[model samples]
Target: MTKTTTRPLAELQADFVRVGALLKQAREDVETLRRLSMAEAQAETLAAELEAIKRQMDRAFADEDKAKEDAFIAGIKDVRITEGDQRDNLIRRTFTVAVTRTGNDGLRDWETTAEKTGLTSLKPEEYAWLLRHPDRIPASILALADDPRTAFQTYFSSKKRGYFRGA
Candidate 1:
């Protein structure tokens, strides 16, 4: 049971009403100002302010509409857009090795193996994906008396993500 700050439909309805009120007031002010003995420059300034206010009001309404549309779509199907690292800016490297059932004693050095198996600059998601992928080293590490979870930990290296805590 999570809490919601916005009351979905009602909040949106209220936002629409607020936008309408502000815009309607701006329009009325403009019409009344035009009939007064004001200089052209003065009138223009007032009109410009009204236009600016109207634009902000319109943005409010547009946001309300988009929220409603998103909610309606959410109710139909759980269509979610998930963002992942695609390694767009990464350089990928690959490797192959000969190994025994117990992972050959001289099979590979971590640095050498990484170079031989493959190394690449990777996006966050790609890093995570490779660690958990069946074709990756997760299964192979299990044979070397290495912790199986090491595969997961390796992908989380902060330098690769370009972020370091308390740096």
Candidate 2:
């Protein structure tokens, strides 16, 4: 291109004004992008915080429900001792099996006798095994039983007057 002569002062001023307007538009775009990015980051942070709060609320709800259930169970202690199914679901057969493996024939004998007698199992022999092998039972039952050491004793004590203890 041919070199032009120097522009008039007014033309130079107009060129500078156009350049300034372009620079200002570029700056406005950058500022808008920055604000959008920061807003996105803030929104992500808030979402994460809300998720944490939801988890906490779930845990608190579970704890509250458990406490209410415990209270409800604690209030119903009166047993009228009638002739019905005294099911013991808490006791597990693992205790009896462990006892059998340990060569404690007493528990095996008791299991055989229970089957031989007219005993239709409603909840398995877990409770009976726990009663016989109280020492070896799981720690989860520690608070549930009347006495971890003498749960079987208490059970046997509650047996019919004319009934003999296990074999």
Segments of candidate 2 deviating more than 4 angstroms: 1-33, 76-167
lDDT of 2: 0.49
Candidate 1 error regions (>4 Å): 1-38, 76-167
- Candidate of highest lDDT: 2
TM-score of 1: 0.24
Spell out the clash pairs found in candidate 2: 91-126, 91-127, 92-126
The candidate 1 region of ten consecutive residues with least summed lDDT is: 75-84
Question: Model 2 RMSD to the real structure?
Answer: 16.3
Report the lDDT of model 2 for residue 65.
78
* lDDT tens digits by residue: candidate 1, 41-154: 788998999999999999999999767655433312111112224343212212232221113247663321121132333333334334344354433323333553453344
